[model samples]
Target: MNAKTPTSPVPPYPHPAGGWGSVKALGISLMRDGAPLATASALRKQNKPGGFACVGCAWAKPAKPHLAEFCENGAKATAWELTDKRATPEFFARHSLAELRGWSELELEGAGRLTEPLRYDADSDRYLPVSWDEAIAGIGRALAAQRAADPRATVFYASGRASLEASYMYQLLARLYGNNNLPDSSNMCHESTSVALPETIGVPVGTVRLDDFEQTDAIFFFGQNVGVSSPRMLHQLQEARQRGVPIVTFNPLKEVGLVHFANPQSPAQMLTPGETTISTQYLQVRNGGDLAALTGLCKWLIEADDIAQARGGARVLDAAFIAEHTQGFGAFAQAMRAADWSAIERGSGLPRDALERAAKTYAHATAVLGIYGMGLTQHREGVANVQMLSNLLLLRGNIGRPGAGICPVRGHSNVQGQRSVGITEKPELAPLDRLAELYAFEPPRERGRDTVATCEGVIDGSVRAFVGLGGNFLRAAPDSQRLAAAWAGLDLTVHVATRLNFTHVVPGRESYLLPCLGRIEIDQQAGGAQTVAVEDSTGCFHASDGVAEPAVPTLRSEAAIVAAIAQACLPPNPRVPWNDWVADYAKVRDAIEATWPDVFQGFNQRFRDPGGLPKPNAARERRWETDSGKAQFIVPPPTEHESDPSVLRLMTLRSDDQFNTSIYSLDDRFRNVWGTRRVLFMHPHDMRARGLAEGDMAHVTTVAHDGHRRELAGLRVVPYDLPRGSVGGYFPECNPLLPLQHHAHGSHVPAAKNIPVRVKSAVA
Candidate 1:
């Protein structure tokens, strides 16, 4: 694992995010790798009213659809799923588990759609296709055994790829079987947002809607790259720029998406080869410095307010809003005033004048929209980082305004939806009382394990079984070196997925791969074709209808598979009619309505809405639902980074040619990384300081002294537009360098954003 393949020199992609280049990339991926006509037809339906939801990211779709609503990533994902290729039983027969383990991530995925249920063959060390009946029966028997040994021995992990209905059943199965060991991708990606937003704004989800972008005077992007994360939002950002809205970006690297954008649909613009400038100012804040940068912004605003008060001038802070709607302002203001300018300057890696300018831009605008991504979440102080942004918004009454609010740009189409319906470890987050009353079972109240804790449980033999709904769980997880072996040691591991992934290769003692229908494929039940729902980032519920033919006839719907697993594993319960629910998805929706009547009432009626239906957000109405009955102005720690000066903070990057954990090819068009994912990005000054040059093979080692000397050797060094004492590399590839124990303090999200590391040139 220490040695990596040689790669081309990382040449930066100078073009804006979407344009002729994106079109070219999309065409290449689809035409060469996927069924072009099939995927193109699917793309026409993607993000449209009653169409399939792109599982790429959770960005909301516009009410009125454009000609092509899908982005390059979404299109690539659709094409990837709608491919003619198949990792069929014959393919498995040709390659043993050991041989497949030697294959690359892209190769393993390129093996394509999993045709049927596969069981691990210990003697041959290969996967042999098994009948669905025998497969689920064996899984049920093993799962029951684990539960019988100890209720906590079985853990269920659901990824964001699952639909709302499928995820609901998955969670129900876990609780009914005893224990609440439900660790999910939400815990790994945006657990910080779930924890911090509720503590500050009285809501766990973002209050801003798609229409809010139209009226926002200013937009602040904290550690988000729109081009890769969700390119569909580029159109809105472009329109905002045209309307003279100021967009200020605070990130370690100047992402091209935040730089400028070209609408691929606009014939005149595309033909003319022109792109609109996106950001008014791009400040390269150091990795792990978001807390400091945000604190500095608040500090300047506070100081200015004090000076204005002394001069008897107009008030800078929203005094009326603060007094009426928020609590803890006095403590927050005092803490901001006490923050040292020297510490802020050092921590942010930007001069005081830059902070003043950014703060003035924010103060100058009456309505400002605050948006952030995972960059602000996967840190030791991630919760505080989010709260500080909340504090800044509260300073000017940004929340509950026409064009202003806090928006956490979540990844995954149904990640929020999954969490909304109780696929979470936190008992209080869900309507547990209602679920218990309706299901006739006492749902466990004890706080359950998260992603990291789940791994620990697996390693220590406490957790004996795992069922992944979807996702490359083992590959995407942090500290791959530590988890893979322990994960294989499990008694049972069931993966319900559409296609092959790295996890399929890392089989457990008793492993089963149950292929499921893709989102683009039609999912027919006893009633007829069913529509699955997904919640976008803006608290809107979108119903998606799959219209394509199934990749294989043997593939079952996720809901049906979950129901079968439940039927096979658990004793019959009249209260929870597993068969009746799968027979009609509408009944499942009615049950979901019954479980959360306050929020989800009239769910079946709302399905008739062409566009998505907005979920009620008290924060949007300026109604504080916190324990204190008011918004909180949280005080952030002055210093965000506590590492040694020599230690560089490494933030993980996503390649343009990939979606989450699924690499399409080796080519990264945005970063211009070709033929490899082992490249490391660093500032030139930092590289010079370490006596490293471009294309130099470097060994990156974690600074953590947790007895695990996690290191990624022979990572090619590439200079990037980043601040000093910071580096970045493609995620999950460099995930090995992140120790399992190093995570967000409160949220427990792995600190993939700012891993403390030291780099040195590797020997040839």
Candidate 2:
């Protein structure tokens, strides 16, 4: 291990996912946040039938509940949100905007929850307290002014933390204001899944449910670190391993979570010293190499099927399922057969025999689940990468069956739900027609800017006003320096959030920070205390009502904030009842039910059920919603392996202590790095090839096709188990190395992974 100047005294963690370390971490978080009693009560309600969902990951709750339903990250998220420390007017008075700007993201948020609405006072270079009504009115006026000038000048952004009702109301507000410039975190994370899944399987969501893990004969994980990102999923994986199921993983780095895990909830795991091994076989696929690897698996499956047919043996391919429910099989098969083996080996950084072994394991299994995360989607050919995985699943008739489907595990709890409730730039006609009928208002038919497009538009002076429902858009996005400048150039910016982030520190010309109730905080309104709902990765719609009181009396619920903004902006409409909707959240759910009747039918009643209703999925029912009325077998074009002996493929990742853009701590326990996020992880061979070694400071420069020379200096190179010719660094910090225009072809998602970079030794 490299010996660099330690950021903290914390040592590298040696054990797997859960165990005593998780307990210790949880205890530390609780103590630091000074909310032990509140956290305990709130955690008990997490993922419960009548309680709030965990704010951490979108992994579904089990049908059978556990006492501790929350994972380690969930505990951190809850503690972080329900912290006793407050960022009050006094705190702001103590620090200047320029001083706060110098602080790290973790430091900015760790200052604690924003107690009240604040407006940036440019004259004083400080944020001062403002009345909720005053903030709302000011934002509404600015939005109206922007609309009068040009509707496209205003952009409405949403974060995944917002509830389904809140998202519905927010989108309604944007559409009513006559702008579809709605871009959310999904554009940066899982947009590829949204684009490719619909084209391939006639649906955009995962076909499998939580229970499918019990029946799955095999599970294949692509670029997902289940242990750190979605720890609860590790329980299911542990059980699968215990049941002798083959779990194959493909990633650029050998993530600790995918290698082994110990369930903290299990008494045996707590008492036992040994941990359960996770992946039966781990393949270190190169960054942006999933497409080639998946194609290789498909090719091997085809070859095996042909050999079986010649020998008059049992068939490997599900021919019956193919003939009945799919299209373009012939073209897909031809493409797979023609895939170059050498190209697959080079692209994937794995030998042909290894891929063959993986294919054999997959072919032998009666049921298989394909799981993936941002790593597959944050690439130049992300859509193609996802389509290739779908192609592999379709070969084995994985769709419309228990334990057999494609599961794109999402990072945010309700990112999928946000899209489901109409928080989208691309509005389908069916939903628009229904919404118009329900609200008696015409929705804008034109397509709006996505995340990448919004950034470009803002930079170019097209987007002038920005309203964020949640999230640190400036930090989470690509080209941080450019984005900061663009955001500052905006005429007005409004953020409804619980805590202070980097985005709040860097204000637009005029900005307002509207403090909102956290997920674990009670939301009281005119009608009474209200409950909000969230959807998990599996499309399960469940209610999430806060158990604790709001961090501050002045804080408002997300639904209330959106409704207030909408009420203030638009003229009074007889058909739309924003006031009534804000008073009771049921009315908002009713509005959603009215719009998407097929999916949200009886939503209010069904949402209260112990296990929330599953959203309607055409792919799960084998009912294709495509033009041909069948799931399409997309034949992704073969991609040549792009390799430069002088440059390494750089992939950006989240530290174990971070969730999305929220940094809990600087320590990344799983990867053994302590107290620092500025270090790079690379294979020893690669470091040696570049005349570098462990703890050597390096300057990393991107080889972008757009000719933008993006670089990050003074990155400490730490030799690790990553594939040769590949390097890894934490995101947000590395986001600068990614060009604004370098993104997936159709999805427009920034290729945070697969950045081509050259590293040179830097004098430190």
Candidate 3:
């Protein structure tokens, strides 16, 4: 294996997920965070009904909680936030912004939590400490000035980690200021699901619960690596396997997690030195091939059902359910039957027999659940891809039934919750009338800029002020170089953050980094130690109260920060009660209930229950809220993006050691790549075809249809098990190659998963 750096020798990891390796990783995290005993105690409280939820992936908590419900990645998120180290004013005094910009992502965050609010000093190019009052006043003044000109001039960005209370406060602040410019982390990941699911199933969220895994007879995973992205999910998969459930995985790369997984918590498996096989069948589909694969499955199922009906056997198609609970089935079935097998095989890069076998499994199963991740959602046809999955489930009467539904696995802990509580660019979807009546202020009704629009706004000088609640916006977004430049051109940029990130250093004319409490930190307000609530991927609303003492005493909770800014910018409003809401988080929940009564009624009381209340989803009751009053079968045309023979389809992936833009380590332990992130994974055949071999340094250039080429140099090409004409690279580093304008059709999510690129040996 070729390593980009010489810090350590690259060796393939032959073991499965979560065994001695996970234990070792946890030990390293504890040592690095400098509080093993405290961290250990804090870990025990994670995901407990009485404690905080894991700040990692939003996998639903098990009904029967274990002593150690957290996964390896969960421990990393906790340790990263609860680190004993502090980045005080003195630390900033020694490091200039220019110097810090050159530092790695891991190095900047590892410096530790910000202990005070800091303002950018352009002359010194260093961050200087500013009082919280002054910081709020300055930001308030800037926001007010921007609103005076045009509320659309200001862009409010929220990270998925933010609690529902903070998310509501942020969105309310933006809307009250007369604009709906609320673009969140969800736009970059699962906006496709948000767009496609409602059109097909009349609801955006998954209908399945945590217990659904137990009852599911078959599980089909598409483009999702659960073992690495959501390790806790492996426990459910392992249990399902034990119950004779067949798991099928479709991904571009043969991820080890999909092949097998070993739970460290299971003493029998750990002591006996054996692992449970995860995926019964693994299909290495081509990048952006999910649509084709799903179409093939549908075609095969339709054929099998026709044969079954002709033979007077039990019908394979759910005729009764489909006839009664669905629309556009005739056209959908006709399209499926007419789908070309050669095209499906070519597009999916899988044989006809493979898809037929998968379809057979689905036809035989009583309950089938389909799970997908960013891989399916981060494409030009992302929305179509998601709808295709929904079509498959609807055909089998899988939806609105026990153990069966379409699940779009989210990366962030509360991204789903953020959307539920009104963190969106679309104003019509928000409960504006209810909010207006409660707050005595008219909310904006016009649709505002999304992530892509926000970037364009900043670049075109339309957006003058930017307020990021809790994300590395510049780095996480595509076209990093241009986005950073546009961000720097802003009049003001306010970031409510716990630690340093790439966005903090890319200062606007007047920038402020207001330190805030992390998920693991105790948020003590005037009323009491407040507990913030988050809705999981499965729509379960739960309270997460931090167990560890805050790393910095001066750090404010995200809710308080938003409220303080709102109080400073907006006029004194007796109805709003900003001060009271910040003083007690329950007041925020009360406001949410009043605004969204149907979903959040009795929120405060229901939140107190050990097991959190599940948000009411009408789809669970076999109710369709669409125009047809039934589930719609959307038959999208075939994927139109033609593959270039000379170009490899490149997809951005997260290292096992990283989450979003936060790099835990350069080493991607699962992939066996160590000490560096500037490496691209390619198939051996593809490398040979390109005259590139292992250890050869290559330059990757994006082949954009608009003729705007983007390139990344000095990337080491390493051989992997990906399909031919497909390659993979770590995100943020390869994000530069992604064009900001090149996004999904309806969702506007940057097509980060499918980039047509050509890789060649570096000239140097």
Instruction: Report the lDDT tens digits of candidate 1 across residue range 1-764.
Output: 22333333345577878898998999899976768899888899999986898968889977898999999999998999999999899999999999999888898888889899999998999999999999999998988787778878888999897888888998999898887888899888899999998999999988899889999999999988899998899988998999999999999988888888889998877989688999998899999988889989999999999999999999999999999999999999999889998899889898999989999999999999999999899998889989999999999999999899999998888899999888999887767788788888888888888899898887787888889999888887888878887888888889999878888888889999999999889998888999888888998888889978999899999999999999888888889988888988888888888887777768888854755878899999999988899999887765766557679999998988888898999888787678999999988777776777778888888998878888889898888778889899997798888888888889999999999998888863
Candidate 2 runs further than 4 Å off:
1-13
Candidate 3, 229-280: lDDT as tens digits: 8988898899999999999999998787888888898888789788899999
* Whole-model lDDT values for every prediction: 0.88, 0.87, 0.88
Model 3: which residue pairs collide? Answer: none
| Model 2, span 347-367: residue lDDT tens | 888899999999999999989
* Poorly placed runs, candidate 1 (over 4 Å): 1-12
List of clashing residue pairs for candidate 1: none
Query: Deviation in angstroms for 563 in model 2?
Result: 1.2
The 10-residue segment with the lowest total lDDT in model 1: 1-10
Q: Which residue ranges in model 3 land beyond 4 Å of their true spot?
A: 1-12, 641-643
TM-score, every prediction: 0.98, 0.97, 0.98
Residue 89 lDDT, candidate 2, scale 0-100: 91
TM-score of 2: 0.97
